[model samples]
Target: MSNKRGKGPMGFGGPMGGAVHGGAKAKDFKGSSKKLLNYLKPYRLSIIIVLIFAIGSAAFSIIGPKILGKATTKLFEGLVSKVSGTAGAGIDFEYIGRIIIILAVLYLISALFSFIQGYIMSGIAQKVSYNLRKEISIKINKLPLKYFDKLTHGEVLSRVTNDVDTVSNTLNQSLSQIFTSFTTLIGVLIMMLSISVSMTLVSVLILPLSAILISFVVKKSQRYFKEQQNFLGHVNGHVEEIYGGHNIMKAFNGEEKAVKEFNELNETLYNSAWKSQFLSGMMMPIMSFIGNIGYVLVSILGGYLAVKKTIEVGDIQSFIQYIRSFTQPISQAAQIANVLQSTAAATERVFEFLEEEEESDNLSTPVDINEIKGSVEFKNVHFGYNEDKIIINDFSSKIKPGQRIAIVGPTGAGKTTIVKLLMRFYELNSGEILLDNTNITSFKRSDLRKVFGMVLQDTWLFNGSIMDNIRYGRLDATDEEVLEAAKAAHVDHFIKTLPDGYNMELNEDASNVSQGQKQLLTIARAILADPKILILDEATSSVDTRTEVLIQKAMDNLMNGRTSFIIAHRLSTIKDADLILVMKDGDIIEQGNHKELLEKKGFYASLYNSQFENSEAS
Candidate 1:
């Protein structure tokens, strides 16, 4: 019952942040990236098409400045000739018009290519996200209950929502940016060199300074980004916990504590977020200043070259444009690096969940559930949530078919653990549980579980109509059958009294109904299941004494000719049980008929007497 397992992969605060400003580095960047890329293998041809489109877009855009430079040179030549009173003295508007048309076509093509690639990439990203969410949903069912014991609901939800979105966004936006940036960088550099090597050298000289400054800022900001992501997850988790238990917090006067905790987490997140954003904000200005210096140098050099007629005036214009284009990609590449880190972190968490050890079904040919009898036995079972600390030791018991058995004990006496072991929720460290003298492991877990119906202390109902919630016990059950089960559980009158009868919808937490109603609904579900073996763990504890008596009668009718195991703290409830199992310190201290145990004046008798005294006092 003491689940002391270590935190699962998603248990560190929660999932990492989704944005570039709050990107966290992966523990195994290369490994995680490799795994992530594997998901894209199915769309390899689409990705290739995206790459081609992206490159074409960048290439076409990069060629525009150089071509426009030709028009500038032509215009300058005609103006100079006109100033000199030459034969060709006027500007050639026709030539300039033709160049304008070419430039317009080029830019239009570039935009079209960009749009097409973006459209394709968006689809790919969404499909990948869909696949990931689907896998996570399926994995939730496949995971053992112990896995959930080590993780919070928020942590698991974060992976399915936030982490997967991060990967998807990165794939959609950043991926195409990467292709375009590199292509632009290369094409712009080549054009710059072709225009004027001397100016190109001067322009390229500023890059080292830009790189050094960008690197310094990135190095300083990386830790803050990581911290931002960490704190973001903590804030999210805290908010989820507080919101989910709003009523409990109010009842306990915990609003101040909750607010204080939120403020602390929010403060940390604000600090990290601003610091990372400020540092990242510095990159563009720094690059621009460095680029301005390059521009100044290029301009002065181009003027000298132009004075000497070494290079055309338009070439200088083109070279300056190329220098500006070149620095843009460098800035983009730097940002993309951080984005990649975030993507890797997100993908790593998703992959970790997907790769978690699923519950193994070792039975190749499982025993049929229909062949199983109601007889149950536990033989010398030794088990623990954590192997080093055993909770159930040398515990053994047997129940004949149709026997009404009650397991009574103080809290943590391993009473619940016995039922958990019987259902194979957690594998026993040693010993075997038998269903009609056959080892339980011989049956598939799904098939074995079909033989039992459980109505526990905690009732669970999803957001649905009362009819749907009840019919969850047997998915194929018709409305008539569901109504029959509800009546049998004594919940029919309650349902009919409501506004919509069984059609009334439960809210997200099913809070519209009272505690007793929820319990009745669960009982209704179990009755609809009509399982051969039944487990009632404090099943009627929520209802009032009058309702409890009514439910008891209904349960008695339902339990007739069925094997039933009842675990209860109210000893008076089980006075007529055919057998009472008294558990103490993970072992059965005494077990016999209720009257026989009371006559013995031992542990069971004392437990029953104490409960009886408490009832009398109340």
Candidate 2:
């Protein structure tokens, strides 16, 4: 039952594997950042308000130290006068009290503005994240299945979850920080210069050193940040793949191999994560060291100026406070720079996925599905998953409105590919597939798919009640219709044996039921659809012999008046088919009814005989 062809190795050149190794630098920081800003366009007014609030908050905080210096000067002068026995020049508690009150009010106003800006920014960030996730969800549906084949589930899920979260968090925390940090830096610089120009010059002398150090760290860290993001996706993909195939892995004694692969991926992630974090972490301490040197130089110079009466003692205190404020935002800006780089990396991956080539759009004037009969025709159809390797070359077939056509062939003989082509899962290279004399291209993909139902060897059942799972075939179906469909698939009796009957809940992986039961539920879903055309690809392969017989009977009833295409490995099950297509190497070697094919003693006869011998031998 080899329904799918074998895929090649997922090498470094593959879509998901391209960034596995290190040295994956951020490709388009400016471009990705610009695109990310577009998401904020709708919230422009709110953002402006946030900026204003942030700036106001920082400005008020910056003014506090200068005003507090006034109280320091007044107390100092009072102490000197009292020590000199000057009664009239004694300290004024009234002035000190007024300064304290004003200081408290200023700080309070700053805190309020800060709170308001944070609240507004959070809302904007969340809305942007919501829009990104919504777009990703819609983009997924528009993407072709082939695009998915080149990537892993975890890789895609990583972009949807981790990448978007990275962008959201940065927007929420960093956007306002930018405004406040810039404001604090400029405001503090002005205050420092107003106190004494010489001290200001001495204090700013360390600027070039801080700038050079920040540049070095950012340059060294950007590539590792990009690599960290890439390996995070790989690690996620590896975990998901291993978890989904846990049973198979254990059965085949593949635990060692799985662990080994995980360790390699985890090791890469570890290396990138630590390197990026360490470089970013170095910024604060390095800046602090440089800031401390400036602090020493400013303190000595301020004392000398005060002794010479060039600046007041209170002015010296205010200048020191300004120096601290100045260096803090520089460090903050440095940290923010690193954060922005990481965000850019994440944003790039997200935009890449959103910009992927989508499936061809629906035709403007689509043929109505209601007018289509079950009749299907493949006219000299040519197709290949890859263009250079033709899987189905010059194949032609015509099916009547109410015929049972069985397609049988050895593994990789293009049996499943035929049905995929008919369903428009993949387009043809140089031919057309027609439904009731009209090209399938004339119909919208949704409309075309609505006319047919498919049950594959791989059963898919989401976590839900049995009744709900069946109703998934047709969302508007009534409970009675679902029950009838279950009965037709011979699964009603099994459902009734459960404690909750049809209402039992399946787990995330639907592991509560046996494999055969899962297959039966999928069959029931197909029956519930009640489509005009049917495709069954080894649909009964998982069931026991007894269950297969019951299901075959149910299938006979369901396919009574519908056009059905059955791809089977066991020739015995399809012996009564109205037409049999025997294929080899993407070409139809023979075609006819079972009796006629047996008389010819060609490919079909050989296949039937081999299966019969294998059954007897077993």
Candidate 2 per-residue lDDT, tens place, 1-618, comes to 111111211111111111122222258999999998886788999999999999999999999988988888888889989999986878889999999999999999999999999999999889888989999999999998878888878579867886788788778977788898899999998888888899999988888899899778767876776667567767766776777678998999989988888898889979988887777667767878898898889889988988898987788788888988887777666556656766788899899999998889557788889966799988998888988999898999999998999999999999999988887888889888889999988888888899999999998898889889999999999999999999999999999999999999998888899988998899899999999999999988888898899889989998999999999998999989999999999999899999999999988888899989999999
Give the residue spans of candidate 2 off by over 4 A.
1-25, 218-279
Each candidate: RMSD to true structure? 3.7, 5.4
Query: What is candidate 1's lDDT per residue for 1-618, written digit by digit as tens?
Result: 111111222211211122344555789999999998888999999999999999999999999999999999999999999999998579999999999999999999999999999999999999999999999999999999999999878679878987898899889988988898889988998888888888888887888888999889878977887777677767766776777778899999999988888888789879987887787777768877898898889999999999999999899888888888988878766667777887898899999999999989987688888966699998999998998999898988889999999998999999989988888888989998999999999988899899999999999999999999999999999999999999999999989999998899999989999988899899999999999999999998788888889779889988998999999988888988999999988989899998889899999888878888888898
Give the best candidate by lDDT: 1
lDDT of 2: 0.84
Clashing pairs in 1: none
Give each model's whole-structure lDDT.
Answer: 0.87, 0.84
Query: How high is each candidate's TM-score?
Result: 0.94, 0.91
For every model in order, what is the number of clashing pairs? 0, 0
Model 1 per-residue lDDT at 160:
91
